[model samples]
Target: MKVKEMIKENNRLREQMTPFNRSYLEDMILVLRASRVDPLRTEELLLEAAQQMLIAQKKGNTATQVFGDDPEAYFKEVIETTPSRPARSKLNYYLMIPWTALTLLFGVMAIVGLISEWTTGSAGMFGQISLFTLLSVGLGSIIFIEMIMKWMSSLSDTDAPRVGKFNIKGFGVYIAIAVVVIYAGLYLSQLFPPFALSPWVSLILSIAGLLGLKFIFLK
Candidate 1:
């Protein structure tokens, strides 16, 4: 073939492959991101894959065909097998010490305040409720932070599955648990006259009841 014809053919092939290449790389990135893979390692793997795909395309094979039917699964498998840098280094563990200290200090203060309020009977029903709510929020935040840390740490270990990603089943379970807890709290509050069920509490119960029904029946 003439040199001019060969050059034209190469340009045509590149133009045709550009969109498919972009799509494949994008899908691979999503898989890596979902798996919590290291950013630097993710980029290196993507570049290497792109180069290999381009070479295959130059040999007249479609990149999509080479990648096969399930590109995401294929890329995920690649990421799982390839060795990468540790997700959390010793420096990261050292940095968390201050955070741990702060959390412990806050927890102790919260417990002390709750005990003082309970003994004195100074805080009104609403005030006591607010304090309990604050405690729950603090605990929930700690749990969420721990989950994120675990997920980050697991990224380097191929044997450890991805963590912290939300699933519908998990979300449903959370909602159901929250509903049950709130309902139980309201039921128990009735046993104590000081925390009598107010109109607002009744309204909350009604809403929760509706949600519980929906969760059960809709699913």
Candidate 2:
């Protein structure tokens, strides 16, 4: 199954678990997802675990009995053994987030433009997205990807689950670095001061780009 489908099936199966077992499974799922496991493999692992957990539940066994007494040790062992996905695939997955965000933003803007045209018999005056703003956005996306990888690496290096759980503590470090990159890009973009896409074009391009991203990035 695809990662998304596996995730859906996993969620559906989790509902059948006893409360205590479900809670235990969720912790494992979170740590596994946050680990260096490949996205496809992570979902595969989760689905498999959920299935086994349900079977165990029927047999009157707890998650701890099936998974381990200390889930953290299990998590560390798994991360140590499972190799991460290729850097290219990881980068593509991160890029999909900003691509989807931009697509939704542009689609909303396009709808607003249509509403304006109907009400006033004139097209809406859509503001151009500034080059500087785009630079900042692009910086944010890159910063997010870098921070996450750094956190995962930290967890792997330390073999500690607490090192980088949600990409929070180390974000300040990434932001400091991002500021420098953004300014450099801003200086270079001075050549095209007024460059911008129209509302419909932005929406169309966003949708097309998202399709490409889904095809290429999502496993």
Candidate 3:
């Protein structure tokens, strides 16, 4: 969502809630947004907020209930009317295009470097550049993948699949796992060989993932 709109909505919600509750709700929204959760799932999000507050209350940590009655109806209405957060799809595409073009150019150069290395039995500056180029591609891909995932997570699917469980059963677990795996890969790659090759590998994988995402969701 636009920052201005988000601020307006936040202010409106705050006005309706008690001071203590408003603070809790604001914190919850910030946390959810940081965790890549959609703000559009206002009801579910608010319930989660309420639960947190109640837990705090039980522990004598904080006593705050922003709503005297159930907030379910209000949250639902907000979700229904609120527009989805905007994605920087075009900006992502523009960024990707230049990277892809550079990758193509580097691929050609790398091939020439390899051929030269075979004939000369020595990798000169061009060979180093080739390796650097590959590394750039791989690391770039990993970063890009993370960025896309983050952007995707920010989006809410109003028609998301669900079962006899809370909130798209197991979704939180999936996100947690994803976060861990991404972090692990990033950490381990720094400690491994072919650190130079990392970027190329990551770039390819990221591009493929992007294509799959587009085909599945944007098609």
Candidate 4:
């Protein structure tokens, strides 16, 4: 194919990929080029990778998850292990940032709201029901988002036979923490009522807390 045609085709293929997959493929290209793999062979490998990704998509998996943890690392390993010696070379947690930030924001808001209600003696059956619902949904969303991210990260381990088991221990820990937090809130309610903050003030505090946590850990 002509150079212009190849470039156009490559662009077309990239446009079809998910953002994560496109980033992976770009990184793989750089690694392969540095290793001095023959251009034709490199293209072949990349095409195969794209095809595999499409197959995975059909099977209800994202390219990132199918490719596993580090696509570039996996590709490098494949190149080194294969008999072909046309060249030599060496090679986020970031994707979860938005989800983590949002999760933390909702979580803090729910917790603070719950505590406020309890201390103010406003946590009657209906109030408690609403507060629990908010907490449950927020927690559930965070868990679901983390699971998807972790699953994609796990794909980095090429040798792992399966995606691994459901996190029973993690679930238990979460339950234990919830129980402790609720107990503390109840105890504090009896000792001292929480001062009421305006809705806007509560929102500001929640956002500030979220940003503080993000900076402390994610930064």
TM-score for each candidate, following the candidate numbering: 0.32, 0.68, 0.25, 0.34
Q: How would you encode candidate 4's per-residue C-alpha lDDT over 1-219 as one tens digit per residue?
A: 644455466667877776666766665656665455555666767767776776676677776687766666767765776565422211023334444555455456556666766688453332222333434444455455555644554332233345555666665766676666566556656565444344344456557656755675445
When sorted by TM-score, best at the front, the candidate numbers are 2, 4, 1, 3
Model 1, 1-219: lDDT tens per residue? 443454344345445555556455455555764554555555555555666678887787755677775556667666677665465643443334434433443444445544555788532343323333433443444445545544443342122334434455555655566566566555655664343333344345445544544464322
lDDT by residue (86-110, candidate 3, tens digit) is 5764444445644554556555546
- Across residues 78-169, which tens digit of lDDT does each residue of candidate 2 receive? 68998776787667656776776566656665667657657876444543566666666666776877665665444432223455355555
Model 3 Cα shift for residue 28 (angstroms) = 7.3
Q: Considering only N, C-alpha and C atoms within 3 Å, which residue pairs clash in candidate 2?
A: none
Candidate 3 is scored at a TM of 0.25
State how far residue 157 of model 3 sits from its true place (Å): 25
- TM-score: which candidate is best? 2
Screening candidate 4 with a backbone cut-off below 3 angstroms (N, C-alpha, C), the clashing residue pairs are: 68-155, 68-156, 69-155, 69-156
After TM-score superposition, the amount by which residue 85's alpha carbon in candidate 4 deviates from its true location, in angstroms, is 7.8
Candidate 1, residue 168: CA error in Å? Answer: 4.1
TM-score of predicted model 2?
A: 0.68
Residue 118 lDDT, candidate 3, scale 0-100 = 82
